[model samples]
Target: MLPAQICARNERAKAHSSRYNSKRMKVGTGRLRPHRSISAGHNRDDKRMKIGNKSGAVAFAVMFAILREFVMKFVSILLALPLTMAISACATTSTDASAPAAASMAGAKLMAGDGSARGTASVTEAADGLHVLVKAQGLTPGIHAVHVHMTGTCTTPDFASAGGHWNPTGRKHGMNNPAGMHMGDMPNMTVGPDGSGAIEYVIAGGTISGEATPLLDADGAAVVIHAQADDNMSDPAGNAGGRIACGVLAAG
Candidate 1:
């Protein structure tokens, strides 16, 4: 009777131990699954962080490019400033240099007493004296006497309204007068066969518009051409004939 009971009890004990070991293995497998899931989540988080870092780098690069472009434009403007100012200054200097030449010239248009001869005269002040340049056409082809008359009036026919030769020095009229020639006395102008002539004269101690005896004076002056040549030695008129052309000297 004792041997059978003992064998049955031992078998029951072995079965209980087998069930406990199986349950422990199932619990270890569940823990392993949880660890795998945690690892997968960590991998996903790492990928997101890497993507964010790359985006930040790209944004920084874009900003740097924009800033560099702005700097380059600013540098270009700074480099051009001096050239622009230089061009402006050159223009101003050129305008300033041309001021005196425009102010120093005087002009006159001459007409014959009988409306036959016509001419132009330009007066300029040089370093030496006053330069008088006369150009004429439609005049007789011979030696003609040209003089600066005292009065500016050139009224008609004989043109007697224009007074005597301009003698601010109170001297005689002729160049060969010996006592001292008048300031208005000039050499004879010989006209060509085509009736065209030119004369240039520099009157010593005479001016267009200065402190000296000016052609454009209070009563003004006249450029007069005589029909005949002056003999260069006669007293008042120098034997010069009638006044052919006369022009008033006006301030311009």
Candidate 2:
């Protein structure tokens, strides 16, 4: 080979090396290396595209965070709804538990000679007078006399501790007697075959308290049911037999 031919071959080899370096990635620091255009078509739009992608990512993150917060708050509210309703229900029940009844009255439980529960009685004050209600049980199916006695004390056994018919005004017993009806005088009670009896009567011009002739005095009052019926014209006793059931009236 000649010297000129060898120089031409070396020149071709150097040109091929330069072309290979141009196609490879550049690793030199920007400040240390001279500025050069990687491609003639490159523009400022590339920087804007990168910035737009970052902005889109930030916006998506912000929206996701807001949605997460909204979902958490909604779930919390749903969880608390039942607790709030339960608290309201408890408050309402407490209010109702404090209230019982709304009537001023008196009551008594009648007991027989053997101390067994026989009946119940109640006295309520109204505009007319003292309203009396008597419910008798465990009694024979027949007519019986029920009267308000003078004393509230109802001794066991005979129940003679309860005095005669209550007469605030001096008068004889029996509604049929002229100028004779006592304050304790009332109609006879007829028991049913089921051993139950009920009677309701309002004593005229009578009162439980705050009056001259109140049914309940310092010693209170007693309700007595006799075994036999009243003759309706009998004086003082009305021929009513032994006291079967007796109860002491108490204010409620």
Candidate 3:
């Protein structure tokens, strides 16, 4: 009787123990499956975040490259502007260096009294006094008295507006006068057969540059040609006839 009872109790105990272990294992497996699913979801989210960061980095690099290119182009343009301006200024300066100077020349263009002649005159300050060179054409081909008048005025017809001879010292008119000799008296000029003549006179007594006998004073002076020859000793124009050709002396 004891052996039979002990065997039945052991079988019952073994069955209960097996059922409890089965239930505990099922619950543990269910919890482990849910944990694995949550881990996988987290890994997928991390991958997506890494991809977004990489895209953002690429966009920033592209913008930086564009900005660098634009800045480089602007800097190049700024550096070339001054060189271009300097070259243009140098070209302008070269053109202004070829003109003639104006301080070494004094001249005048002669107009005829009766519109029958034209001439030119040039005066230069020399070491002695002043040198005058005069050239005339289309005249009457005869002896004519040429004198430097006091006034520069030369009107038409009679040419009486040229005034008297250039007598700054208030002496007599002729070169051989008894009381005095006028500074404006000059030798007679003989025209050629072709109605053209040239005279070059170097003034030794008077001056065309100084203030004493200045040819280019405030009132100025003129070269007047008479119709007749001078007697050289007569007073007041040496008996020369009417005025023929006159030219105002201009200063340079």
Q: Estimate each model's TM-score.
A: 0.59, 0.59, 0.56
In candidate 1, which residue ranges exceed 4 Å CA deviation?
1-103
Q: Which of the two candidates, 1 or 2, achieves a greater lDDT against the reference?
A: 2
lDDT of 1 by residue, 183-237 (tens): 8888889999999998999988777765657767778788889999988888787
Q: Model 1: which residue pairs collide?
A: none
- Could you give candidate 3's per-residue lDDT for residues 35-105 as a string of tens digits? 88999999999999999999999999999999999999999989998998998888877765665333334
lDDT of 2 by residue, 181-218 (tens): 99898889999999999999998888887668877788
Count of backbone collisions within predicted model 3 = 0
Of the two candidates 1 and 3, the one with more favorable lDDT, higher being better, is 1
The candidate with the higher TM-score, 2 or 3, is 2
* lDDT of every predicted structure (CA atoms): 0.86, 0.88, 0.80
lDDT of 2 at 112: 97
RMSD of 3: 12.4
RMSD of each: 8.6, 10.7, 12.4
Clashing pairs in 3: none
Best model per lDDT = 2
